[model samples]
Target: MNQNTKIYGLVLAGGHSRRMGTDKGLLHYHNKPQREFLYEQLQNICDAVFMSIRPEQQAELPRGFRHIVDENMYRGPLNGLLSAHHSFPEAAWLVVACDLPLVNEKILKYLLERRNKKAMATAFATRKTGLPEPLAAIWEPQGLRQAEIYMKTAASSCPRKFLLNVETTLVHPEDDLWVANANEPEEQQRLLAKLNII
Candidate 1:
């Protein structure tokens, strides 16, 4: 880790979870809330970490750590990214989604190693999945400003739309293990079963 490069960690936990039928971040996958697992893991790789959620759902969220609300009321993952950018304008944030239980310190360190100019974003790019996963990408403080402008002007609130406009470095997907995101209960069960935790 570069001492000069200060990076924060952001856990995107704002999803409505209509599909999961509950707060996805709070669901237990391995005897722990998914968000707590992510938060603990991110703590190993970042200077600071915070959960991004909606203001109305704040009460149902777990305590012990702080959270950032998307006051803009803007929809999509972009709202979480923008909120993190506004809260910590000085540090580059590694924006991760809570559903990605497979994310680890090694992957985060890999991204940090490739971080170059503020204009460049380091992301994972699989031949199967082009561009870094937006929710799993590294965002520089300056990049946050650019994303804000895009969100304000775009008719759609897609994070990918904002990322496409920026300069980025891509890491090809080497293993399927790195990109596993538990979107549904069955997927969550499979991940835990694969890990031999269930």
Candidate 2:
């Protein structure tokens, strides 16, 4: 953890989950909801942790947890990320998506250890595709500012694409599966099998 930088954890849970037919964040992955699991993991490393959720999903959120409701009508993870930035512009956010069941403390620790504060953002590079995993990333204040500027443009609002064009530090994950995201029932089943639950 960089002492000079105030790092906060933002759990992206605002997704519609149309493909999963349910809220992926509410799914049980490690004897608890995935969102709760991730929130606890973030609590260990961050000064404060907040879950990014849509307004309608507020009733479904677990009690005693701090959250930021998305104010933007834009679709996708960008809405959550930007909303978080808007709420706390001074803090660098270690954003994590709820669907990443394989994400553990070890992976987050590694990310923090190797974080390049000088860069706009520090993210992991997928071993298979060699592309930046934007969701599991530490977005510095400057990076978030740039993202806000990019959002105003006519270009695509894909975070990965923004990472590709920015000054970001990307590192390879210790284990490929550590960054695996289960978005659908089949993917969740596969992850469950990998965890020896099936």
Candidate 3:
């Protein structure tokens, strides 16, 4: 069924960035903050978009896009996902991390094309790796409810554990470019070189 569902685009920007010693989302690549580029790309497909930010960093958020503060106070991306799911329970949520440099339009389109309403969620998977990249996934409204229930019982907000219980659909990572991310300085440099932006 072509649901034509209005999937909400959620950019996970609540990470502490302890490893990098800087906000990963605010770092620059190609003269634009990484998060802005991601939001720009995501806007192409999402019916509406919002950035998930930590409460303390709310002032640092870019203008124009709506912001959803993580009210649950968990230290993982699941908190942001749950917040969005709760806010828009009637629609699927396209959750993406802000630091991923390679999540281009092509891969996003491919993932969206494979979405099944019957499944709890859908995500990309490389044949070599299992369901490891939770950063790039689609969460149905029902999946969010399942996650919320699991989280309430588990008393923890781990996305992996939540995913274990849901009916998640998977897609082959035929497009390796979507896996590119800037986790550290070296990785950022590599992304710049790969994109020929530096």
Q: Assess each prediction's global lDDT (C-alpha) against the native.
A: 0.76, 0.89, 0.78
**Every model's TM-score:** 0.87, 0.96, 0.89
Q: State which candidate has the highest TM-score.
A: 2
Candidates 1 and 3, the one with greater TM-score: 3
Question: After TM-score superposition, what is the CA distance of residue 149 in candidate 1 from its true location, in Å?
Answer: 0.7
Give the best candidate by lDDT: 2
Error of 2 at 108 (Å): 0.7
For every candidate structure, what is the RMSD over all alpha carbons to the true structure, in angstroms?
A: 2.6, 1.7, 2.2
Overall local distance difference test of candidate 3: 0.78
Which pairs of residues clash in candidate 1, taking residues 3 or more apart in a chain or in different chains? Answer: none
Listed per model in order, the count of residue pairs whose N, CA or C atoms clash below 3 Å is: 0, 0, 0
Better of 1 and 2 by TM-score: 2
Q: Candidate 3: list runs displaced more than 4 Å.
A: 1-4
